[model samples]
Target: MAGALLSTPNRVSLERLVQVAKERGYTAQGEMFSVADMAKLAQETLGCQAELLCGGLGGPNRDGVLQHLITGHPLLIPYDEDFNHEPCQKKGHKAHWAVSAGVLIGVQNVPSPGYIEDSELPGLFHPVPGAPHQPPSFPEESSPGAIFLLSKQGKSWHYQLWDYSQVRDSNLQLTDFSPARAADGRVYVVPAGGVKAGLCGQALLLSPQEGSHQLGLGHLPQLNPAH
Candidate 1:
């Protein structure tokens, strides 16, 4: 319960999740939470939409810029499958706001580090052709190319998001539980059981800076005995 505990509800218009994030070092980007009640996310976190859960105030003006990023599914927003960036008004696409970002994968029920946005990074990785295994790394010196954070739904990224909003508010409840936090210290895994049931919680690896670690599936030793 010490790590990513359940988010407490804001029965009195006070989001304990937001408070905890701010105290720990993270800020929410959505309109629902204010700057005073925010953590790491200076603007909007990643500009990506979590499956059924939506983030960043969407409107005719907002979506017009980067509408393609809003794929309804959070993971799809990274979108390595569609490498051609012609830049158009796609239904799911949302404008990639120019802000330094980092990949933040949250394992549903394990201990891990907290995600903080930064200008540097592990580098931008886009899937490549002919070598789907070797992902292309785009250097982001001044700004992080992508902010890959993990979440279950509209309010599922931070542990507090669920404890405070979902379960507490009861506004958005996911019938499926998922996003299993892996033991590798990275790569949040939403096991089928988690998707069907619900996540226990996430672990918090203490770190001073953002983009501190990268996610690994932790099941490759068996898959690739060569190692």
Candidate 2:
């Protein structure tokens, strides 16, 4: 899904992607695909360069995610479903994947405390109702912002607007597994017994290979300087 969004005209089919993963031994019989496996598949199938970005102690930070999105590059973020702060019918240690498309900075007139409105994306953020509205804090030069996510549910894809702080906290609270760094400095999630894992906040930045198609930034919103 991510590869198809970032890649150009030459998009690989889902069946073909699975075939390639199996052929390259990226996945075994009846096993969940690891982050590294997905990255490798993106490279081979979509012709993208995947760079793993990790956060200290906490997984990926808001600034790091914003930086990557600012460059018009989509990111593959993995987080625990329970920590995502969204209403879920059934949830546990559900490790899920989401692709970030854009970001909106300096949200004005928050409807409620700790919540911001998402005019561009579907669904309004109203975590707290009737509470006094408080402005969201961001980096020194950045204003309050929200991230745009393209998430998959069953066979359909949905666009969501997630608060920056919520994203940061959820990522920090992710207790799914850990990614192991290879000798070449590449990180891969290899689930093994006795291996310390969990509380991993990481994201994979997908860059298009040379001569590949790129997503245009004209339609995406940018950070506007606060008045």
What would you estimate as the lDDT of candidate 1?
Answer: 0.22
Deviating ranges (above 4 Å) for candidate 2: 29-33, 56-61, 82-92, 107-156, 176-190, 193-199, 211-227
The residue-by-residue lDDT of candidate 1 on 44-139, one tens digit each, is 222111121122212221221121121111121111011222212222122111110123322233222232223465332222212213212322
- Measure candidate 1: CA RMSD: 20.8
Worst 10 residues of 2 by lDDT: 218-227
- Give candidate 1 regions above 4 Å deviation: 1-15, 20-133, 136-151, 155-227
Residue 155 of model 2, lDDT score: 27
Best by TM-score: 2
Judge candidate 2 at residue 125 and give its lDDT: 52
In the range 57-159, model 2's lDDT, one tens digit per residue, is 1222445555556555677765545434331322114445566665655544443454655678654553333344443443443334434343432223466
RMSD of each: 20.8, 10.9
